[model samples]
Target: MSDPVSEAGTIPVNDSTPILAYGPLVLDVPGRPVPLAMKVSAPATGTGLPIILLSHGHGMTTFLSSLRGYGPLADFFAAHGFVVVQPTHLDSTALGLRESDHPEAPTFWKSRPAEISFIIDHLDDIEAAVPGLAGRLDTTRVAAVGHSLGGHTVALLRGMQTRDPADGSTVRVPDERIKAAVIIATPGEADEQTNQDMLNNYPVNKYNDFSTMGMDALVVAGDKDLNPMFSDRLSYRWDAYTRAPGPKTLLMVHGAEHIFGGISGYDASETTDEDPERVSTLRALIWAYLRSQLYPDDPAWNRALAAMGDFGTVEAK
Candidate 1:
């Protein structure tokens, strides 16, 4: 079988450019048995390109949460002139491990943001690993994008907060280094607006607070993405957009699901709303969003603002 990620072509470029990918970069820390591992991809030729720290969501299998998922978004962003980095968190089933079960199971949630921070801290090392990529990255313009549980992690980087169940105290893990973010199908704050089902899934969601998420972010929600396993109300997905401080944007796909049109995998069966057109539209909007945010003069941002209704309604504040 061809490489799933490589087979999933990049964004359209008239010049016939290539995307350079380097993988399984084992990022080791002192005394850590297995160091953090990730895959890095970027345009074959581009200087001062923005960086995107991608965090994968939790899945039943390891591949989806490991460095193997989100090829569609990763390939497109890399080919379109951004450096993409994805790290495999300890919660990956591939590790054949379970959360401590000590108090809560934000196993992957707690470590997700740290991993992004780590990649940002070690950009020099990461660039050195990718041949001809050194000095081509624009560290000043970095973004964090994630899906499902991964999106929750992205919110944290943008300053979302959680409360410790043990003491009912707030636990904040904010990384101001991330300038912008894209949160796809992430959950919301669960106080009065939260349904009974959502509060039960993860006690942590009940304590989620987005008041401090004042950074520039694009929140994507699926109109029909009613996750029975997570929440009963479809509107629960919009909490990140409504509750978080602006400037923020919300994209609600007409009839999408948690997988967001097989974004987690090339052809995963979980994509109940697998419309290639919608997926393509989503990919384009994100590309434009990032492009516009990083480059003040990129017209894609303004165009995206006007044309967002073609795919879904956009609410910005």
Candidate 2:
């Protein structure tokens, strides 16, 4: 398939090259149109490959920029023969929300499941419009990787039920293609202090119902995060739960912070310099998790998963 250039026009998309950039595909959802940036890369042979939908953290604009900032996380996956798709949620960002229109706009963190569904629906269109990706995508083995608010969305996407506090009605998310999920620095039920404490005031129905969703999950957080309590609470909730059918793992990156190794770029900043080793370890861990779940029978993936524990501070409850 011909590689579609991004809005930036800087990155090249050649089949012979290691990475291909496509988009800004305008994805239309219920009441909004979201501009998305996607990066697709595969092995040299270009055969069918497992698909991984990469959702960025809040405030992130382009997936390619993220690759430039973070150390080869996506590249590592592409090298392993998986096609990576990173979708940007720029229109739905917290900063983009109109305060008057959405009085409780901040609470839309829970709306991530809907946003993800919209992206998945549009990706089908992308595969059709672009060449080479038509039947190459394995939707059944798909998994989502979300950071910060995106992480909170992954948890909600995993089928943790939620209720409307005012009307007592249940909200149903759209896509069921997500077979597994990884949440980084997710927030928990909020404490009582903040004014717009969505976590505190929001209605979380239950955590025990994810078994029906049938998706394996992994939750990773930083031990030295400014919001360590919130991250810890989220990890604890997943650890204590007994109903999820697939395996669950919780990891804490020692000396890491809330931004998950300082957003993909800005590595030279003081904040990012705090724990470079932890950042490297975090990326390696994610690669291992993706391999085990997405390419289970591959012996190389199994070996990488086995060696993962030796690289970081890992704990599975």
Candidate 2, 4-111: lDDT as tens digits? 422111211222236554544445565543344455655544656677666655443333233232324555456556677665554234335523355234345445
lDDT of 1 by residue, 1-317 (tens): 74333221233322325898888988886443358999898889979989998888877766878887888888877877788998887777676554555343545466667778888999989888878888898889998899888898898888888876667887777787777789998887665545676566566787788988777799999888886556667787878898887899998877788887778877776677776656666877887887777777878767765766645778799
TM-score result, candidate 2: 0.71
Pairs in clash, predicted candidate 2: 1-131, 69-264, 69-265, 70-264, 190-199
lDDT of each: 0.77, 0.53
Report backbone clashes per prediction.
0, 5
List the RMSD of every prediction in angstroms.
Answer: 3.7, 7.8
